[model samples]
Target chain A: MMKISMPRWFYQLASPRWFYNFTSKLLPWFGIATLVFLCVGLVWGLVFAPADYQQGNSFRIIYIHVPSSILAQSCYMLMAVAGAIGLIWKMKMAHIIAQACAPIGASIAVMSLATGAIWGKPTWGAWWVWDARLTAMLVLLFLYIGVIALHAAFENKAGADKASAILSLVGLVNIPIIKYSVEWWNTLHQSATFTVTEKPAMPPEMWIPLLIMVLGFYCFFAVILMGRARVELLEREKRSDWVKQLILVNWTQ
Target chain B: MSFFLAALKRELLLVFRHRSDIINPLAFFLMVAVLFPLGVSPDPSFLSEVASGVIWVAALLACLLSVDGIFRSDYQDGSLEQMLISAEPLWMLVTAKVITHWLVSGFFLALISPLVAMMFFLPEPAYPALIISLLLGTPTLSLMGAIGSALTVGLRKGGVLISLLVLPLYIPVLIFGAGTVQAGAMGLPIQGYLALLAAILVFSLMLAPIAIVAALKISIRS
Candidate 1:
């Protein structure tokens, strides 16, 4: 193991045990923040937020759709970056984090798509559109699914991680291209009138809750990502002495 | 330079020896084109309207099917490992491999696409557009699909999984390819779409081999 001399934080971040212990300390705070922000944000957005001038209450789906969509894209970015780190540094922890991201990101993408569909009915008068944003989200879902499928297809965990890491990196490079081409194709053919991607000037009353929801979603994502990564770390490192000691301590307790 | 030529020659020789390796996907491409008429409509007007899209999609899928031809045999017989360990830069070897892939899949498909165009009653002007777009687009498709093939070369049955992994990446190529042909059919300016397709080709040519080499290394290492 030739580790080029690097900063302490880099090595610390590369260690699964360090990550588990550190995240365990932060998890409670993230969990509480997720709970408070989500509850408050949902209540604020659902109740206090002013109804859309045109669509009335139907626009409320934005609280869910926008947050999940934002989270989905960010999750992919994180997964790709983590994968690059894993591939470059041979860091098992980074691989675990990237693997943890695939399913969660896919689920979030599905949520975003579902909420967009639900919102589309009242807003666009249809359940779906080949609009640029919608099509890109669908493609994102497929990319996430591809990463998961690639991971599942491999027999060895290390190979699975490496294979999927390459896929995620490839996908990361393609997302913007896919979004642009889909937009170009949409405008060329569909003559779409109402673009959901446009953020019209919303009053603070409308946007504040949306902002809170976005924050809540990020916190919630972190809470889940950390928990998932920690569990994956435990499983991958189960053969290690520290993990065995930790497991025995927990069992005795 | 010589390494690339040698690699290309080897691949060309191999593909020539196993002729079905070249014929199967072309037959599959023709079959897919046939399905558009049978499955959709034989009406000339409707078929003409969709002809570009139908041909481009069929070409994309055909290229995808042949992508395994890029690395599968090599992986199976362990030449992939040998290549990985070789002193020659992996990219040059894979680039030769990809060029050979495009020759069999993209080049021949473009050469024969006019026939598919005529069958679908595509207008005369669009034949050039269809051929050019397929010519430009399918190389990118082959390059991109090679990455998927390299990644999945380790898997036993990577068939549908390869489609799942590669098709999204193919969308830009598909859009520009079909759109260019559609533009030609409508007598609209196709230069813009053709330019975009070429840009995508250049972009993927620069990057896809790097990804393919990396993916092949991953598959081989694992």
Candidate 2:
């Protein structure tokens, strides 16, 4: 196989030591951004954002619900891409990132499903419905749990990483088909479907805060992923001198 | 192609040596389908309504029952590692293996589905639809299940874990397979549902062997 030349920084990013140093420097900024954005976005969306005429106050849960939903899917995409990169380059750093992604993505998926259920109560008049989107999200949660379980089942770290990576990438391809099929199934069984939740168009007042919430969620995700990856990198690379040095310095200080 | 057939024949011979590998899933399929009626109302009208879904779900589980065994015997016996390192392309061998899995599991499930459907009081019009949908849909199930089987073949409790990995991926096929039969039951056109099942079959056929090959390497190396 021909090797494609990659830029110097690509290799740098793949190195665990370089990644630890770089993220250590960048983590604080991401943390601060996460805090600021989340606080502002939550306050604005939950407090100031105009409510849906049909559902009134209960509709406000969309502030958290929509962001968590979007981020949950994005997290899967990130996990799969990171897995792909790790497999292609055999990069420990990439696998760490992918490993770090599973729990966070799974938790975020839970948050979305929970929030959606909360919103569903007042909106759909039920706690759960086999709606297309909800069913797809439920399957997404199962996919995440599978990845996390597979990763844990492997006694070997390398095997765990590669196996879960392959699974997640396979999931990446199936998700759309799953989503589309669920949507089709929903249409076929249209009795339980609700048209009430469909808003004509979001007023800028409503969507602007949503945009902010989405941004906040993305920042929060980046902060958490980097934080987890940093810890994983250290744990996996503890025998390396730089990790040992960093631990020694941190412990002493 | 000859190599592929030889590899497939080897897998079939191995399964035949332990014949339960062929009968267990079919028996499980029969029992599971029976449990649905016992758990739910066995009233003909009610059973007829849910029969399509019941059969599809049961067949899916039966396939899962056997799929983990696809690589388990080979992994335990040391043949999987040899195949992985063999000069022959691994994906071809994997495809052959998955096909045998389908032969033992999916193909037989399709054959017996109408018997279960009759027990569920499935409409006479839907009989052909049930068989065709299962025929088209089961290979996809086998392919998708192979990825999970390959991933977990080395684990002591690979069977349950295979379900956790494979069942979620099986949803589309289940939906379409049941939909085809339900459409036929309702005297609606079955073409659309069959097409969807065939589409999923094609998609999985193209991609799943690649994932299986990758997963088998990961499992073997670990």
- Cα lDDT over the full model 2: 0.89
Enumerate residue pairs that collide in model 1: none
lDDT of 2 by residue, B75-139 (tens): 99898899889999999999989888998999988998989999999999999999999999999
Give the lDDT of residue B81 in candidate 1: 91
Q: Which residue ranges in model 1 land beyond 4 Å of their true spot?
A: A1-7, A187-200
DockQ of each: 0.92, 0.94
Over A48-148, each residue of candidate 2 has an lDDT whose tens digit, in order, gives 88777988888788888888988889899999999999999899888999999999999999999998888887777788888898899899999999999
How would you encode candidate 1's per-residue C-alpha lDDT over B1-222 as one tens digit per residue? 999899989999998999997888889999999998888789999999988888988999899988976788888888889989989999999998888889999999899899889999999989889988888898899899999999898899899999999999999999988999988988999999989999989999999888988888888888
Can you give the lDDT of residue B142 in candidate 2?
A: 92
Best by DockQ: 2
Give lDDT per model, in order.
0.90, 0.89
Q: What share of the true interface contacts does candidate 2 keep?
A: 1.00
